[model samples]
Target: MALVKIIGCGNPLAGDDGVGLKVIEELKRWGLPPGVRLISAGLPGLTILDLMRGADQVIIVDAVEAGQKPGTVIHCKETDLARVTFRSLSLHNIGIAEALSLGRLVEPEAFPRRLDIVGVQIAEITWGKADLSPLVAAALPLAVHTVYNILKGGGPYA
Candidate 1:
């Protein structure tokens, strides 16, 4: 059986930047499949490495500012991460891309065989803000569905 891990990363205080954490919270209520694990990996950084290690497959959900309209949910493979620029509101030395790359190098056997990212476009990342923007809030269900599809063996972006 494959170990599928869903890790959501973001800062809960940074407005729309917290969409990842919100999605994770929503998923908890819906329940999860067998062999699947969910993690609220806030602010990522080096913590993602630990969260992903030993997983056969991994899905990371986070906010990105890639010049798209706010609330747009984008699905991408691990290889595609290099093309998309992630938005960071925290002071992390290493972002998701760097962390995954280092993880693969440090533990080839433990590194995930498959990896995907569910990114939501953000309109703002203002400090002291705890709620998501209306646009992003609306996209949460779609993001959750997308992650569900992937975990059910529907494949990436199904």
Candidate 2:
């Protein structure tokens, strides 16, 4: 059974870092396909592995600092994450890449069969910032659509 899980990771307290949560919010309102679970890993940090457990396919939406323009949608496979060890992912102290690497060491079989990462390039990650930047806000629809296409459409907004 292919259990597709969309894991949105971020903290609303940080500026553009919260884009992942925003994507999750909009996806929920759009009435996504049944059986496709949406998990908000709001600053999950080290607990990310637990959120993704048992998922046959996992799509992680987060904010990344790729030196690209704000609102840029970056798509990547799980393996690609390790290549950029210096670049941070999701504005966390320990990035998603590090978490996944550590998880693989602890429980190799617990990993998903397939994994994809859809990231929104961040402008800034200031604490106490509760809103997205103008450019990031404008790119919400595209972010939503990117996630939808990853699902390969099972129904509306799919």
The lDDT of each candidate is 0.83, 0.81
Candidate 1: lDDT over CA atoms? 0.83
Off by over 4 Å in 2: 83-91, 153-158
Tens digits of per-residue lDDT for model 2, 1-158? 47888999898988888999999999999877766899988888778899889898888889888878889887667777755422446357678888888998999899888777888888887889999998888888998888888778422121
Q: For residues 4-62, write the lDDT of model 1, one tens digit per residue.
A: 99998888998988999999999999898898888998886988888888889999998
Q: What is the lDDT of residue 114 in candidate 2?
A: 77
Please name the candidate that would achieve the greatest TM-score relative to the true structure: 1
C-alpha root-mean-square deviation, each candidate: 2.0, 3.9
Once model 2 is optimally superposed onto the true structure by TM-score, how far is the C-alpha of residue 124 displaced, in angstroms?
A: 1.5
Q: What is the lDDT of residue 71 in candidate 2?
A: 90
TM-score of each: 0.90, 0.88
lDDT of 2 at 87: 44
